[model samples]
Target: MDISGAGALVTGAASGIGAAVARRLAAEGAHVVVADMQEEKGRELAAEIGGVFVRVDVTETDQIGEAVAEATRTAPLRAVVNSAGIGGAQRTIGRDGTLGSAHDLAAFSRIIAINLIGTFDVVRQAATAMSTNEPDANGQRGAIVNMASVAAFDGQIGQAAYSASKGGVVGMTLPVARDLSASGIRLNTVAPGLIDTPIYGEGREAEEFKAQLGSHVLFPKRLGLPEELASVVLEFLRNDYLNAETVRVDGGIRMPPR
Candidate 1:
């Protein structure tokens, strides 16, 4: 589980929590691969960390394979963080409660494809690469950290698609870890709450909106920081004893259904 001089692949590394995790891994001496769809930002961050960037759309198997391959080229792939996901909010039925007003099928499908299926595909590919590595003294080849959300548990109104996708991640953690146990590849999940990220808009209006959202937190009365979430990811990667667990990084807040 030692990360130094190893290779780490983090999806959605262009921004938000994924970006923070990528930087942290690099700082820990891992050869980080910034896998994201945003070329400009991904390349910028990769350069910043002296790492490599691979434009990856997790839903595409070919792109995911390329990312895994890229990581192996750097070093023995030992760490992977699946932080690629999208958010969608729409009521199952519109205000009028009419048939045509049902949630958009395409939108729902897209969220699931990216958040759930995409995460699984990347993990599978990464595990395959890690399986080839010689185990360390602890008999550990690698570890994976998957990004889930508090929505997977306390989903609010209009969060059907997002919740379902994250729920799928939480549900699969134990089984996936068990499957990877023989290969010495451990898997865990982090279910984060409201973290200050680009998902919130910019400028004064956005700041004001974010403040209101932060007020709901149980303590410190503010949104979580991306670095705080990244720290937990590092623990998951470095702590060989951790596996098949979903830890929530929320500031003691159980979301209220709106």
Candidate 2:
């Protein structure tokens, strides 16, 4: 789909991969809506990109709906990138060996709610808006790119909840694409490995952690940049035939059990 002069919404757009994507889309001439919980940073980014900023909590359906509505108010919504998610680290069987110390059900549920269910919610609402738009030359109305993780395939130790949530994203990609095919909306996923983002900390501590993770990568012995992931997302958006696929943006790394 030609996103130029159209509207696009990106969740978690305040920082990291989401920020990179919002910037890229704006550069490509799309009117970006930076939907994120960080009001300060989101507004700053929106101002920088000449886009709109919407405070959004992905887990809240009404908030997502509002964001989508705002995105479509100016131009026909053409793209959505669901990059809002949280990481969790807890073994199913805790090292404490206490029955009450197992992975907290609430925590697991929260991760799934935000990562999996939240992604679906945004896609559904965004697709609803896109459906009203006149189809492009390819009969395409919009494109959706979801954020998954390498953990979904090769989850390391203590990544039960994270893996499960991301796995659900990978599992649903094709089905969602099929469901939206009739509307000329395409859906795909990008699974990143050990990316160097704020989520992993900063300074010397983060460098050391990245070094450790980078050692596992097959080549380019370094952490993947957020921009690298954003590049892949752009490909998925521009390539109309690249639907119902999950592309791994890891640096050829198959994470080993921690």
Candidate 3:
């Protein structure tokens, strides 16, 4: 996709990875929509990126529809980055000491709703707009990037809901790619390990965590920088052939059992 003058929608754009992706897309000359529930932050982020801000609660399909429609109406929709998600430490057993997600259905349902379902909502809508576009000379259309996590593969103790949400994202890559093939749109996922993002904290002591993560990687032992993730993201856009695979931006972090 030619990012220049193209439009993009990024969920969870108020902070962290989503914010980074949004800023980067704007820098690349894409008209970006900062979709987030936090209106104040969303507005500020939009100002910073010189993009539009759409107040959205990704868990609701109606809000997703409104955001996408509004963004598409303004600019040429070419890319979508699904980055809205939550993380927490909750065991399969609820605080009530019950077993299975069935025992804590509400909690599990919320996680899946905001993460997996929300991601799909944006992707579906973005792809719809992308397909409507007249393809480029090579029949290329658009790109959708789904944010997953290493937890999808090596979830530790008490990571049940968050892990399951991300696992679904990882699981959907191939099917989504196949479904979008006819439209000439590409789909891929990015499973980031630990990163130096606000989801942790701005600049706390990361040495111990870096050391722990280094043991799992073949390269430098460190939490990935947001730029690292952005690099891969831009690379995916540049290489139209890349699709249906989840790129691990982690520095070999297999995650230790907690």
Candidate 4:
């Protein structure tokens, strides 16, 4: 799809990878819509990118639908980035081995609802809007980019719940892509390795951890920039052929067992 003049809805656009993708797409002429729970940050980002700010909590279907509807008022919907998610850590057994308790359920449910269900809600709602878009020469209606993480592949300790949710997301890629294929929509996910985003505190990795990652990664020793992830989304939307795949953006860093 030609990004120029295309309407785009990006969840989690207040900061990190989503913000970068929003800015990049807007720079390329897409009418970007920044949807996030952070009203202040979301509005600021929308202003910065000359995009619309539709405050949305992706976990709510009504909120997601409303945001998409608002965005479509400008241009025919063309693209969506499902970047809204949260990371959490929990243990199956506490230090006393009391078996998973209320805290465990809370952490797990929250993570799954926000990361897994949230993505699904955004995709389902936005896809409905995108299907209404006129197809391109290749019969392509639109594109959807979802954010997964390296933990889905190699989750460290204390990440059981988090990892499971992300794994569910990564696992759905092929099926979701194939399901949406008939609608002329492409679906894909990006599993980022340790990136230099604010998600990592101060972008610091333990020396031992750094050494371990260096042993596996092929290139780019340092953390990945948000722009690197955004670049992949841009191409995925532009190419018209890439589909139903989860491309790892990690620098070959398979997460270690914590």
Candidate 3 C-alpha lDDT tens digits along 9-97: 88988887888888999899998999999899899999999998998998788889988887787676888888899877766655554
User: After aligning candidate 3 to the native by TM-score, how far in Å is the CA of 256 from where it should be?
Assistant: 1.2
Clash number for each model: 0, 0, 0, 1
Q: Tens digit of lDDT per residue, candidate 4, span 1-258?
A: 798998999999999999999999999999999999999999999989899999899778899998899779899888899888888776677776566443468778889999999998888888888888889899999999999999999998888888888898899889988889989999998888776556544434655554554566667676678899999989888878789888998877777687
TM, every model: 0.99, 0.98, 0.91, 0.92
Report lDDT per candidate. 0.97, 0.93, 0.85, 0.86
Best by lDDT: 1
- Decreasing TM-score order of the candidates: 1, 2, 4, 3
Better of 2 and 4 by lDDT: 2
202: Cα error in model 3, Å = 5.0
Sort the candidates on lDDT, descending order.
Answer: 1, 2, 4, 3
Least well predicted 10-residue stretch by lDDT in candidate 3: 94-103
- Candidate 3, TM-score vs. the true structure? 0.91
lDDT of 1 by residue, 108-197 (tens): 999999999999999999999999999999999999999999999999999999999999999999999999999999999999999999
Model 2 regions lying over 4 Å from their true place? none
Clashes of 2: 0
CA error at residue 151 for candidate 4, angstroms: 0.7
